[model samples]
Target: MRNSRRNFLQQLAVSAAAMPFLTFEQQAYTPVPHNRQGRVLRVALMGLGGYATRVAEAMQSCKRAKITGLISGTPAKIKEWQAKYNIPEKNCYNYETFDQVKDNPDIDAVYVITPNGLHHDQVIRIARAGKHVICEKPMAINAREGQEMVDACREAGVKLLVGYRMHFEPNTLEVIRMRSAGEFGKIMFFQGLSGFKIGDPTQWRLDKTLAGGGAMMDIGIYSINGSRYMVGEDPIWVTAQETKTDEVKFKAGVDETIQFQLGFPGGAVASCLSTYNMNYLDRFFMTGEKGFVEMQPSTGYGPIKGRTHQGALAQPHVMHQTLQMDGMAEIILDDSQPVVPVDGLEGLKDLKIIDAIYAACATGQRQKLSL
Candidate 1:
């Protein structure tokens, strides 16, 4: 929920002469109605995996959202979530019986937390079931699949939101707000490094058929998406480099580490890195003419810390997933758009960049982005 001071400040307009360099469009902040009273949005957790379990736990703290249904390939996991969340037997379903979810009025939406490659099909199925969808990031393995998911949801008249939780994170939003206020001057450059060492070599993420790619699809996307929003502009071109230390572990068609660069329309540039063989590299740094903002553990599931050239950010910490679920509830129930959008189109934009990055890496040449 947005505080009164911030709410009032968002409604205030700055003169074009006062902040000629700032993009006035990004400055308008939408305040969530903390006192909003309505029916709790019932969501079914699809894919009872690690992240899905985290979301389910966070939903318990959501004021306007509740986990009322479960869908999983593993019946044991489904039974666990059902008993833990007090979900009815009728709300439990496997992939074969998932189509029957269409008849369950208790469920208003399905949060697709499956692997990247599965999002396209499952999202379409959820839309066909007459339920809104909240798909995890990467939305799909490629832009084509992301667009299909978006089109299907639109055809079904149900909303499709991507689970880009960082967009709802407080500290990240503060940086965006500061950038929009001209505090960062004219944004000129961004640097993002996101990587983590993989533990299990045989995990589904290493399978190109399951993950679509390597680190880029799994965690590097944070750097890709962060560059766009932090710079407040779409990238016009991309150049990339891919390197693998162990061919056996990375396998063919999968990447271990990728370093990519994005050129924005204004000539502002972003240098990013994504890998699965490194640890504790999560960070984002943006610099404008006058000042800079820096964050360490930037995209982690945590108390993300950052400071601007002005001073320490001093922002309070909140669970990223908890804030995300509440913000999503408001988006679904009230038809309100968030300041940092997580809509399907936003997901598609990242996928387009990902596609370009991969092409650049493959061809050893700069790839143009239509987005």
Candidate 2:
């Protein structure tokens, strides 16, 4: 038994040492900028789905945030998550009863990770319950719904944040930093391709009533939101075209694929494609007058690899969700500003663009955007 334990420890040490590709020589010990002693943001996860599971697990590495409570419709899932996260029974609630969280002091905020259709109603109720809300992307089905959520939180005197995890990624931020510093001079064009051959026809994402739309609602919003932040300007106009190869599966109001274009105020144009019938399509490329950036596997879970005219982006990979939760913790608890805005207004802008895209597709004409 002693020998086996010693061998296991040695293997673990070897794996740890092999993780980082580059390492600095030990000299003066320097700590990263984090206040471990500060107040922790106790967040209640409102959904126990796959993404919520990922966020809850990643938050275990956060210094300033924790999963203090859980909200799920399934009692079995709540019980399972409670045992996994060491959550007290009082800190758990179902969708039908989460309004009681208003009296639960342990939960400072609730992250609504439910489906797109459920965000608007759930966020508004959480705000009225006197708790801050961190809603997942596409804040709502349309700009009108998104605005209502924003107004509800505002009237209730609470914060409403969007779950844009990419905003805090180290590599993505490094590219944005370069653009702000004039390294990528006068950006001219961007291309975002986000898609995957989806599975399961009975899933809610394939239902127009539940998902609000098709690929545009579920995956296309990435390019829509990514264009604004990458180009550093709100779009003035949008033109979109839709294609449906499997009408039987896609059904009415659910799109199979979409190709859209966004015209920025600075004359920068973005050409993007969102689909549910293709794979190996996750990529983003932006070119400026002086230099350019390219990223493949851009919006996936980890190791978003990319390069630019200068050289490869050198920022080491950190768990994107880990950085996102910690950054959100600072924003909620310490009022820290983010490099990229993740507020309800920011989310509303994306919804406005989405409305325009869908309109353009339906009318077969260019839609003018004011956001």
Candidate 3:
């Protein structure tokens, strides 16, 4: 029982996928429709970090969502966001007391953009407050925590989504649509390279306790999740090997680099690399009997360029977070499902795969995955 708006988006996606002959001008300028309708989702962001600032900036262009409130432990950051976003004093609260959001009529949801370790408790609390939740990727430290958040949201009767912005990217969706239509027959392989060099030794991401791990927790999950969607199947097994060039900086539990392999049930194989000691490593490639797709600078912020055997992908490039927020608004308000899911279950699957990857790294053996 899909909603009307969801059906519309699906048909629009099909239309776009079918028209491969469309000129660059026509495709590049095809912006997502504006939100002129009345019901904008009032959202309170629970983090005031660098990424949160980016989301706030991007929300200015969002049609169906708006920043209505702020939650942070630092009063300085809260005041700064309040003044900048025109948030009233009444709509701001510290981490110690955000549960009072239940009484606030303006906010319909809370977007949790905090660190890896804090997601489980924070999301449960926000759900208990009777608000839908949109959390950043790698939903929690592991699948167990992600499942708890999912169950809490289910019990509280609220929608739980993850910030998998790529799921809504026009070019990415075009590829997915093509795959679903069997343009690429009998999938054979996928390769994802996601990484960047580490600059700071003191950031929370370097702290195993706060981050739950290192490069894998922060950036590696991209390749793990990418392999699933590109192959259009969940992996059944994973074999991994870890490398740490700087023992002191990366710590014992934190990983500096990991190369992992995924085995899909459909006889597809994927090779992925995740690292914190490398640069120029963002790419995804997949091949089948009929066609192939390659994306360089694949998962970066903007203008995600790519080409398939069909030709270069000409889909419009909106800010990833902007499209994500607007699409999430539809999911919350209209109960519409997007072309690709960004729900809590999707996030949990990624976590389950991550858990297996880490286990493989530790045991130096193939770890089986059921997700």
Query: Which one is best on TM-score?
Result: 1
In order of appearance, the predictions have TM-scores of 0.94, 0.90, 0.91
TM-score of 2: 0.90
**What lDDT score is found at residue 362 in candidate 3?**
89
Taken over the whole model, the C-alpha lDDT of each candidate is: 0.86, 0.85, 0.87
Off by over 4 Å in 3: 1-37
Put down candidate 3 lDDT per residue, 11-73, tens digits, no spaces: 555666677653211221222455545789999999899999889999999989999999999
Better of 2 and 3 by TM-score: 3
Q: How high a TM-score does candidate 3 get?
A: 0.91
- Which sections of candidate 1 miss by over 4 Å? 1-9, 12-29
Q: In model 3, what are the clashing residue pairs, if there are any?
A: none
Question: What C-alpha lDDT does candidate 1 achieve relative to the native structure?
Answer: 0.86
Residue range with the least summed lDDT across 10 consecutive positions in model 1: 8-17
lDDT of 1 by residue, 127-183 (tens): 998999999999999999999999999999999999999988888877877776678
Ranking by TM-score: 1, 3, 2
